[model samples]
Target: MAADITVIIPARNAAATIGAALASLVPDRSLIREILVIDDGSSDRTVAVAVECAQRHGLPMEAVSVRLDSAGAARNVGIERASGASIFFLDADDQVMPGSLSLLRAALERQSGAGLAIGASIRRTKDRPDKLKTPDGYSPDKRQNTRRYLRNELWPIAMGSALVAKWAAAHIRFPEAIHLDEDTCYWTALLARADAVTIEAPVLVYHHDEERMARRFITAPRGTFLAIARELDRLATAGVERDALQWRKAWIAQRIARQLIKHRMFADAAGMMRAVRAHKELGGSPKALQYRARIHIGRLTGIGAGASPTTHPAMPQRTLIICHDPPFPPTSGADLRNFGNAVAAAAFGPVCLASVAPWNGDAQPVDHDIHVTALTTDSQRQAASLGWRRIKGEARIPRPALTRLKTLVRDFRPDTIVVEGVALFKLLGPSRPLVRQLILDMHNVESDLADQLPRKSIWRPRFSGVRDLERRAAAICDRIWVCSTSDRERLRTLLSKPVPIDVVPNGIPRAEGIPTVLPQPAVSDGFPVILLVGHLGYEPNIDAAERLARTILPRIRARLPAAKLVLAGRSPKPPVRALAGLDGVGLVDSPDDVRPLLASAHLCVIPLAMGGGTRIKILEAMAWGIPVIASPLAVEGLDLTADEEVLLADSDEGLADMAVGLCSDRARMMRLRARAHDVVWGRFGPRAIRDAVRRGLGRNDAGS
Candidate 1:
């Protein structure tokens, strides 16, 4: 019998379960040639257990002892002494599934080339051991497979599932320095020189009862990350995908930075982060920029909170805004409002913004013409900790981002500094005397928002400290800009200070700038479509969306069967996302460009139970010549007359009936659309808001 397979296991101190691994080979013994257990400094009775198990199962086994302390080095020894033509790498804590060996062997024999045969196997997670998860991105095409692997879209190719020909295996070696993901390096090397076929059958199971990679990383965090960086560099050199590799490097930097932080390896972590900024040239990469920004944030907090005193050589006067989140590529309601203000501020000069960013791609906010400085992702995380906020009595911007902002402040040399949102005004407290005016832009009355939310809401405002933060800002500002006179009145009462509040009513642009109309949609399946647009994650928006889908949409659809309600927005919460599954309800989620949806929509509906800010969505619909139907609260800030500029209703039944009436009455719809368009065009347009911003800056002249 020609049993030509050799199983090489590099193990240390694994005695209890090595017998199961040996027994798993017994059924396929006719195919197995020999087994090599390279004991890499094992203190337990591992060698004896392996020998006894192999002998008991009638399989030839070799026990080789080495004090190398590295699994890669022991694996190298296994390669050196292997007698069989085909070599399979297994771990002491893992085993081949029942039919996986025969399947892999057959797959190799059937393939055109003598190379690597990979089985679809699993690395069993600790919490769910019995449930096997098949590895993803297993295309028969090797090039696509490798690309997917580099991008991390493909799950890890476990070592136990790989069976490489001995001759091809001789060409490459496992990277001894990399303790984690060493097989990835070795397998990628093999994949380059030799052809590989991925078998569909299940092959191996890697159990997590043994020490996991995350726990092992606590010991050599820096070393592990550094090693990964080196391998990434090599992959980049080999002409793998540029963007994917860059993202991988930046993600690795973030991982290593956290690890170092956990182990209190500050100096090394800082050094590593700096090295990435200097040499990696990842300025355009959003993920990398996030890591670097987090590094900057560290310059103001915990250990690295001090910096060498330096100021910029005086730059030309510009308006700078310190906001909470990025304003570019305008995705959410905050982004839309911030973009409008930034545009208005830019009439002075190119405005600069300092905003928060996060580590994951989810929080990636891009820079537009207004040069934006990124804040650490932790700014929101730390700032939003309700318990921490209660204990500290106030939330402060992360020190590193604040320090970076100070540098930007020096360099930008703003005569007018507009601090957007109350959450971020803490950084601009009287450091440099060069600034002429400091304007506070109030987006909403936080106390009003707090009052509007249900008691059970986790975000329900417990802002005893937040009240103080606002009052403190009101006490020391040149002027305050509120979106509506209602918010102005609320602030006047809450702060009880004569801080000259200006009603800068939030604006939407005229249709001349953006493509006003997309080509009409071909299908009328969702005819007389009623649209609701906003950031779906916000509590008020979530409540409104759920209410419409669950209660109001059904009523409207019952009257006009083809009247479909469309909820379109960014970052939808679960309740809002769930609305899409309901009959007669459509959801357009996180669209890259929402203009098409807006242009094609027939009617805009806003039945909000809770809200504070002026609805930008209402203005957008009016601009597109679509009639609006909203609850009184939804239309609170806008200058619209009921049944004239827009239709208004307070109850769900009333709102649904109003929507049905508007869908059937084209003439009335046209009149409301025209009048509403006039309101937005006259009072809430770019030109009008610019004039208001100019007045707020105390400039009656045309130029800055």
Candidate 2:
């Protein structure tokens, strides 16, 4: 119990919070004789604050200000300066919680068996001290007992705010650069050489300020993986056993995957794909490998089909691109911009995208990269107004017209013809045996949508026939692709096909991978900017906008007194247009760009109460590193947690409260942003997705 405990705090400008952090050390003042504050080139009164705080608290604290560029360097400076039997790293923005020092000291006393003692931190609200926000629990203390931790919330072993033996601390120092998750590198380094112990008690209260919190949560995960790769390189330098080191890397990769999934960062599909690849490099187990694969499959199925067409770079692969609309100019969510991109990405040699839409007189410019062909037939033009569709009477192209497609089929000579819906399959003549592959990209189950309509005779029969054709098409196709597993399983039960069904999810084009750093928005321009991004042409999006304007925005404006709603996306129809002139609603119609607007806004809102399929807007917002508040249905396919990355609600009042909660609590907003980015980079990055695509394409690619 009489072991030395060195408290290492890497402080930047801590004039505001250092006193309280130092004051919290009263319990173990005698035992914790060495408290080192590594001040990394502070421009503020941090050194003076630390000195005054130490004297006020009646404790011995040393402040060393090194002119270094990053916090990681500051941590290393503390490690070198400390001479205690144990070491504990704390952040400048956070305060040491009650009983943390004593508990950490006691745990480190038994360091002969364990290298470090890890503790969890609960995030505190910036405005309201009464509200304890964002509590993260650590892995269970029982060593090698991974069962209980898996069943409950378990934080991974990271260096910041965690206690470690001085000897272990000396051996494993923080990387000198990288403002990001430099801690992960240290964690991996420690885990490789030494075993860890996790304490369940709260030890730190991470103050979720705008600047630090946003960078830490959203941008850090990307760099964390980059650092992990660097750590692997370091292991190589240190001459550690390749096999053992790889296992450690795999363990880290697994934890990262779990964290990403837990937060439901739908955009992180790519990162998950990379994790699977990294795990394989580390000699991963079969179970470990499947973790990301299953997630990839889940995300793929969530988007239904015909969101983005993706293909591996190699192999003599053939692809079919299908879309609900003409996809030219790609204005809508399921448009040709994404369709053409996917087709090009998926096809190794030649690709053809077939679409169905209302024929307008305007000439549509087609992309030269991928072959674009439209088959706009009369079946769609037979306006079946609101549930008037009859099963047998459901319009299909006449037999004579079906024969005409033979010429188009003969000319194109496509190996696979990807159809967006069953109607296209019905239009293609059955006599043509030349087409080797028939791929169906079922964007949504027709019956599922029809079932949502008011239960009526016209609706049921029409839906029933559509369902039958859906099943019939499945039997003939070589492979069926859906957006979510929900659709796949639902269709599997309907289809007679023995053919394989897979998911090729919709994906956001990798956004340059650049962090857009902007000054925090104005606090009092009489409007706390509330942003909603999505095409208003969609029923669900329009419904969400209506609800927010009518119900939620008023409540938020009343509470905050300066709240404003920013409606952005393509095509605002008459009803959506009316909300713009309303008191708090500010509409930006069909902006060629929405990213810069999203960055400037205070909060992104997704109050969707209706519709299905994954909302890529949520994913897109997350990828851009913005915090979002969405309904449970809006985040249906995503792995999101309540009060974490998103705030889920049903009622108008509930949604209004969430807006107020996010507005009042900047720390919570920052925490949500961090969690959002972690979900995105961890689950949906391009690298991860590319790997997943390779796997889905029969594991034939070299990357796989």
Best by TM-score: 1
**Tens-place lDDT digits, model 1, residues 194-274:** 677777777887786432443344333444566666776676544456665665665566556655444333544565566
Kindly provide the TM-score of model 2 when superposed on the true structure, using C-alpha atoms: 0.50
Off by over 4 Å in 1: 1-317, 358-369, 377-396, 430-434, 462-465, 509-523, 702-704
- Model 2: per-residue Cα lDDT over 543-607, one tens digit each: 78998888889888788877888888787878899999899888899987676776667777777
What is the TM-score of candidate 1? 0.52
Error of 1 at 481 (Å): 0.9
Please, what is the whole-model Cα lDDT of each candidate in the order they appear?
0.69, 0.60
